[model samples]
Target: MRKIESSIDRRRITNRPIAIILAAAALGLFASTAVRADDSVGTVTQVNGSAQIERGGATIAAQQGTPLKLHDKVTTTDGSVTMGFGDGSSMALSSSTSVEIEDSTAVNGQNVPSRVTLISGDIHTIVPDKTGQPHSIEVNTENSKATGPSPNQ
Candidate 1:
């Protein structure tokens, strides 16, 4: 009887830790999902005709004023789109173009570390004037990368 009771006690101790670990893992998964649901980075300011936005593992039609999020990919089939950031900077994508919003951060109403990848076609960007802190717009293509005009320009 003494040996049986000791075994039962040990089992209970081990099970309690396992239960706690499972609960913690569940909580972490829930937290990560919630964070991803609220990730908006910019907005589609202009849509000439038809555009599509790939976001959250899905592709959806894009229109003017459509909200954009991190890792979002924008594609213009027969039209064009203009994406505007919070810092007054904008990217104009030509027809048959594809671009991805890789990363962006705003500081004091200015864009910092703003970057985009042009998968195909042409894009024109207008960068806002810089403040004291260094700010730039980076555009990456399959073959090249372009950084914005210097703070002096």
Candidate 2:
């Protein structure tokens, strides 16, 4: 009887820690899913004729769509426009260009976290410095691309 009681006590002690670990893991998964569901919206600060946006392997035309969100992409031809997103981050595009907004976040009424890929032609991005947050802007051409500190940068 003594040996049986000791074994049962040990089992209960081990199970308590395992249960706590499982509860913590469940909470983490829930938090991550909530974050991924967070939507980011973007607008055409400047536009002309017809423009289109791409994302998740799909393309969205300017007129047919309301707006765009994070991980969304944009394309243009024969016109130019500027895009402003949730965190005050903005990008200006020239004619005959295709670009992607890899990430978007907002800060102080501006889209501060931003990333763009210019598939062709030229584009200028004005990146804002948000407090202590990582920020990056990328421009891609057909053969190559560039990134830096300022829009003129």
Q: Best candidate, TM-score-wise?
A: 1
Give each model's whole-structure lDDT: 0.77, 0.65
Please provide, for model 1 over 26-138, each residue's C-alpha lDDT reduced to its tens digit, 9 standing for 90 to 100: 99999988866656677889999999999888999998888888789999999989888776667888889998888868666444336777888878776666553433444
Cα lDDT for residue 66, model 1?
A: 88
- Can you give the lDDT of residue 93 in candidate 2? 75
**RMSD to native for every prediction?**
8.8, 9.4
User: What is candidate 1's TM-score against the reference?
Assistant: 0.61
> Model 2 over residues 1-153: C-alpha lDDT tens digits?
455334457778889999999999999999988765657566777787667877678876765324667666677787876776655566777788877667655655544335555667777765455442324444546443445444332
User: Candidate 1 at 27: error in angstroms?
Assistant: 22
